[model samples]
Target: MTSRPGGRSARVREAVLDAVYAELIHRGYLGMTVENVADRAGVHKTTVYRRWGTVDVLIADALDHTRETDWPVPDTGTIEGDLTAIATEIADTFTDPERRQVPAAIVAAALQSTRALQAKQAFYTARHTEAAKVVTRAVERGELPPQTDPLELVRLTCAPLYYRIFVSGEPVDRTTAERAVQSALAAARTGLL
Candidate 1:
């Protein structure tokens, strides 16, 4: 089907993203090409080139799409509950083989590409913003103390999960997620966060 103007652009973008992600998973970043993505998405090479201009732009766009669809921070009324929910969501993402590989690949790419670094920053910024909203709400509701630092709380809540996923290359199971949540809560309660 031919793409329209407004909504069709988004559809084309999604198709390109899906194609790029598939190529990334199957062949890694070094092997990914606009021509291959266009072929996979059933579009011409010119279409991909015209839209994204470069491979880095396409990769960045794909990463942004992946994060938007997959990462969702939860709000559960209380700080502890909200954090547990967020931890569970994070654990689930890290444990998913496909999802985990995407971030791993992106990190490798980010090391060499400034565009990749910007994309990673944007993804984390979105997550941090969502988390900040949750923490801010908790403070307003008296679930957390007024002096609580939202950014620090977010770091405390997510650091362990990232550590396990990236450093140890371990699966983030429910038990581990719960432990992280508990540890963060303990520190938060003690006014350390």
Candidate 2:
């Protein structure tokens, strides 16, 4: 059957994804269920079951929907400014209590489910590709070598913040964000990245 972009199916998908995100944020992966999601979405259990089948699929679909959403890449006219903006965005996100739960839940779900893991990987891959535009611009402007890997630079700028937040349990503020940007930029400038 042919699909309409803004028809009933689209509306149902959006509602279900929104409900999944809310469920993940409030109840997390462990507490969330397919019935709860369907009820929260105002849809029948069978509809959700036929479309999503399971909580992991629901969460993965939510992540995929989120990945497809528009994310404005920073354009500050300088690599440092752009990368700092990117890193700062990450810091701000995880530092917030409610917003942090979404990704934390994604990570937790990924550990237990291959579907969630693939979704998480695809989400980051899309984000990295989009964020790498700044590094590409930097190369164009002669700020970095043409051989520099934009994805690597983007990954480097984001790695330390994730490490601190998920591993070392350290605080990540604007200072930490800027530091990560600087280190990544330095590595790129030195032909290390």
Which candidate achieves the best lDDT against the true structure?
2
38-88 in candidate 1: lDDT tens per residue? 999988889899988776778888878876875556767788888888888
Model 2 residue-pair collision total: 0
lDDT of each: 0.81, 0.91
Candidate 1: global Cα-lDDT? 0.81
Q: State each model's C-alpha RMSD to the native.
A: 2.9, 2.2
Off by over 4 Å in 1: 1-11, 25-31, 50-55, 65-72
Error of 2 at 34 (Å): 2.0
State the lDDT of candidate 2 residue by residue for 98-184, as single tens digits. Answer: 788788888877887899999999999999999999999999999999999999999999999999988999999999999999999
- Check candidate 2 and list the clashing pairs: none
